[model samples]
Target: MRSAPLLLLLALTPPLLRAPEGNQTRIGPAWSDSRNPIVTTFSGKRLDLWSLRPLTKAPPKRSIDAFLGTTNARTTDKRSLARRLSFDLTGLPPTQSDLASFTTAAAYGDKLLGRRSYGEHQARLWLDVVRYSDSNGFDWDEFRPLAWRFRDYVVRSFNADKPYDRFITEQLAGDELVAGKPKTAADQDALLATSYLRLGPWDNSAGLFGEANRVRNALMNDLVETTGTAFLGLTMACARCHDHKTEPLAQKDFYRFRAFFEGVTFRDDLSLALASDQEPLKGLLVTDGDKPPATTHVLAGGDLNQPKEEVSFGFPTVLDPNPVALCKPVREKSTGRRLTLARWIVAKENPLTARVLVNRIWQQHFGEGLVATPGDFGYAGARPKNQALLDFLARYFRDSGWSVKKLHRLIVSSRAYQSTQSPRRLSAEQLRDAVLQTSGQLTERHGGPPIWPPLPDEVLKANPAFLDDNKEKTKSWYPSPPERLGVRSLYLVQKRTVAIPLMATFDLPDNAVSCSRRTTSTVAPQALTLLNNPFLTDASLVFAKRVEKSPEADKVAVAFVLALQRVPRLDERRLCEDLLKKHGIPALCRALFNLNEFVYLD
Candidate 1:
């Protein structure tokens, strides 16, 4: 009887059982660096550049000035800088007075960074990097109702400018960080941060060989990849089968890292029960036992069945160059391995943590990173274009107490950051937010479950599974009241299997892996969506209504201010006025919304 139930359970929950096929290690084509000097000597410090010593000179502005061409640089016009800063900092255009204010760029940046909206803007970028989703990705695409708690936690952390090191410690080992059961708000927030470990796409359906170990291995692989790429800037997953061909990571190092996570119990039931929604902030998405799996082995050729040798919990060998002595012995009650690993990652002696973080911050501000490959900083990654500038920023980031907001101020205050804005296509979220802003429909509501924005008819037609009439009809997977449609794009439900038409058309990431950057494309579908999508068309009418009360002479100017955040040039104003007279307010508003400058960053 027991064997029958076990067999039935195995049949019901299929696993993807197969040796890894595509997870091969390879040196990237661009990786030509022969000398790995930085891996050994890099301290992420700037003591040599400071003027504290007798022979040492002050930090030179040569790299920054040269990058900006500051000698020949034109004065940063306040209005132009304000517009750029507003978009970069808050994901919204500046107000008229914000453009005209006597405040310097640094002062304005400080103010913008203090706003609640700034954190939302920053969190959205981090969301892409973390593979955040409201639904489990595979075929079933079940809802992750409790995931919103984690999302809100991220927003709060960014707004508070939580120390990056502490942030890492909490996310990786929050349960260990907190004593006793979680009760207070601070305890709940710490517990929720560990949701970082559970963010990857998961499939419950049994696959090929159909076994529990296969399923568990797949989940473990995702956790390893996310941690490596997001924090250490190395593709540690590449070392699973063989030693990394280009980077210094070894196969033993991979297994040792994998050992840390063996004790975690990720409950699928957490999403299946209504009770799971109660006290979401107070509850945890994962549970860890004191006795982690007693053994982890070097799987020969990444084959679970062919274990070669058992490995103990430890840090990567290449980075440490020796075995890492744990901060404390494993307790009789618990393994306590995760907290130890977290400490190693954020330690002052770790060369990659500060460097990787500062590089990501640089990428967020500029269109590109000094190291173009933001996630991979190994020998397989691009060489930093300006090593001194990269080091300078990394050192300052650490020295300034790992405060993300302070780092933001330092970078934005530089001449390089205030340089002429390079026009790029608006991101999917930015486009959605822009539409809401122009129509005067943008809302400040924050936190809670994701909102379901109206989707296009084509998207509904493609995914008829969501269109059942008796099942509460809507074009999207989740139906919402009309008033709930205009929440921030950050709050929009992200069903990985069901892509939002507007977001898909504008290159929203697939959310299947860590996405350091998004591809920008100019295509006919984007134009068609802008011109014909009901979301855009309806928003245009609402926008027209908001500007309709203005006098005809001022209507064009008002529309320009509302849509583009600037007054229109005389010729542009004349063209818009002609359209308003010949056609109507709707047509003029639609035309303004469709402008290239309206959607692209200045």
Candidate 2:
């Protein structure tokens, strides 16, 4: 029988950030070349640009500057350039103030440097790869109020510019790396990082397998998929039932890889949750999803229900190019199988591991990857958009000991990363939230339980979910007590029952599995969210209040600083004064907060 959703919470993949991959592949959008080109920045599309675009089209500013320098007629169209640049930087539209800043800067050949008023700007791509879900997905999508812990963990990690190596080890073998046999608080946090293991859907409703073996296979699949994507850049799912059809991996290789985690179980969950009457609730009480003893068989149809030839566990041959004979553990019961498996997956000789993670880091900053498909690096997948560059960056990641933060600095500091945002705009979530923040409405509070913001009556009615966001009536996604409404989006309680419509429109997944990329969709529903969503309305008003909340030592200046994180220019000041004069302070503040300038970064 399926466990309670709470129990599943202790089990399931991290929430997926999501993407338009499946659709994007079918529709085939051109590889965007909006970024500035620097030798230091290696998005493969640079060389592919002319081939993809009309040759007659004018070149990007960075391209013009590179060829002819500023002295040449590297003329840029202002309106298009500003809109394009703003969208790229902040994920929002432009406002009068934004135009003012950009025009002033543009005149001096500095405007396209990118905007500084990013509202919740940067988006992390790896979360989807890891398959992050706040709620534990099971028979009934249950609410995990504290799943936000992991969500916040990821956001904070990105915000802090956490190093990649430590991040990986902590999640992969966090419990293994702990100092003592008994994990400590620090050790547990690291171990909990492996909560990455418990993510995925389990079809245990039939109660078919021996209790222990099902958990074992479920956990093993997690370990394998996670390793394949996070490191090797392969989709081990190809190897699950048979030899990989296209990739060099053979069916035996899949089993061999499975051999490593053959003995793992849901009970091995490293991040066991604790409970209390404390101010902020912690994780749901849980045990490591450790498995019990079981046999390894080549399920005739890869079906646990079917009996076939019995097979001893071993590593996949595709990974083992040299081919080592497989061995089972000495323990009569379950093998400490995953321990050995994790060892081999992270081994240096394995070519794909380091490359995959490095590619991910690159994808995070540039909005694209050396290998556009982060999880699938096989024959069916697109070749590395730039193989040489992918290899170079991979080697750098491996040689540098997987320092993610170092890579970020290396990237962001580059003129390429710091280049203007153009052509494409940021996602709607970024727009709304960032606008609120830039308008001086972003809440500074960090961790604790997730809170429910208001929900749409139509959405609720359409879905027929009786759950109340304000109460635990049916485990609302953000059912935090009224007092705790200010938690980060990461802190919002997760329920697979129904996603926030705007978020779903932005391609927030069902949280059923780890998703590597979230798709960017331009739809009218999003416009509706901006225009009428209670959350957006509240954010605008809250931002307005925050700007005016302080005593008047230059209320407008304080407002601008809080909203835009910068002082208001004369033009902006005049605009605000006119707005206040026309509609009064509250209306003007509300209007300014709605401007694209307040939300976008560039």
Query: Which number leads on TM-score?
Result: 1
* TM per prediction: 0.84, 0.67
- Model 2 has an lDDT value of 0.50
State the weakest 10-residue window (summed lDDT) of model 2: 10-19
- Estimate, for each residue in 355-453, the C-alpha lDDT of model 2 and write its tens digit: 677666666555677677777766666666655455555555555666554444444434444445443334545554555445544455555555676
User: What local lDDT score does residue 496 receive in model 1, on the 0 to 100 scale?
Assistant: 80
**Residue clash pairs of candidate 1:** 14-206, 14-207, 15-206, 15-207
Per-residue lDDT of candidate 1, residues 168-197 (tens digit): 887887766665555566666777788888
Could you tell me the TM-score of candidate 1?
0.84
Positional deviation of 199 in candidate 2, in angstroms? 2.6
Off by over 4 Å in 1: 1-72, 100-102, 207-210, 267-284, 328-332, 461-476, 550-553
Poorest lDDT segment (10 consecutive residues) of candidate 1: 47-56
The deviation in Å at residue 258 for candidate 2 is 2.6
